[model samples]
Each structure stands twice: as structure tokens, then as C-alpha cells.
Target: MVLVAVLVVVVVVVLFAVVDLGPPHATTNKAAIPNRLR
Candidate 1:
């Protein structure tokens, strides 16, 4: 139970970090997708 809680907290922290770091990469991917389709 304790281990599960720790894992959950770690996952949440990683997710927040990803979101904080993700916008630029996400935008680049979004822009690239249209070019790829074209």
C-alpha cells in the first residue's frame, strides 16, 4: 500500500514535468503532422 502510494506520487510528478516540458514539442509535432500529410 505504501509502495503504491509512492508510485502514484512519482507518476503524478513525472506527468506534471512532462506537461510543463511538453508544449513546445507538442506544437512542433502538430505543425509537422500537417506537413507530413501534405
Candidate 2:
């Protein structure tokens, strides 16, 4: 149970990180605008 909770937390954190890394919002810096389009 403890291990599962830890795993879930890790997955959620990773997903949040990935979402931030993946989105190309217009508010991001101009330099990031280039590559963030991917």
C-alpha cells in the first residue's frame, strides 16, 4: 500500500512536469516559442 501510494505520487508529479514541458502556450518566452511548437 505504501509503495503504491508512492508510485502514484511519482506518476502524478511526472505527468505535471511532462505537461509543462509539452505545452506551447503563447505566454512563454520568445526563445522557447520556437522549440515549444513541437
Candidate 3:
């Protein structure tokens, strides 16, 4: 159970890192989403 908890934490950290360093396409889509909603 402890190992599973550690793994989940590590995965969350990696996901955060990837999102922080995300590619331009991902950022563009995020921006475009708001405009599309309007």
C-alpha cells in the first residue's frame, strides 16, 4: 500500500511537469478553447 501511494504521487508529479513543459499545440488548444466557447 505504501508503494502504491508513492507511485501515485510520482505519477502526479510527472503529469504536472509535462503540463508545465507542454508543447505549443497543447497551449494553443487551451487558448483556442475559450474563443471557441464564445
Clashing residue pairs, backbone N/CA/C < 3 A, model 2: none
lDDT of 2 by residue, 1-38 (tens): 99999999999987865675666555664556468667
- Cα displacement (angstroms), candidate 3, residue 4, comes to 0.3
Q: For each candidate, what is the lDDT?
A: 0.72, 0.71, 0.72
Q: For candidate 2, what is the TM-score?
A: 0.55
Best by TM-score: 3
Q: What tens-digit string does per-residue lDDT give for candidate 3 at 1-38?
A: 99999999999987865665555476576676566568
Model 3 whole-model lDDT (C-alpha atoms): 0.72
**What's each prediction's TM-score?**
0.55, 0.55, 0.56
Stretches of candidate 2 off by over 4 Å are: 23-38
Model 1: lDDT equals: 0.72
Candidate 1 regions with alpha-carbon error over 4 angstroms: 23-38
Residue 38 alpha-carbon offset, candidate 2, angstroms: 22
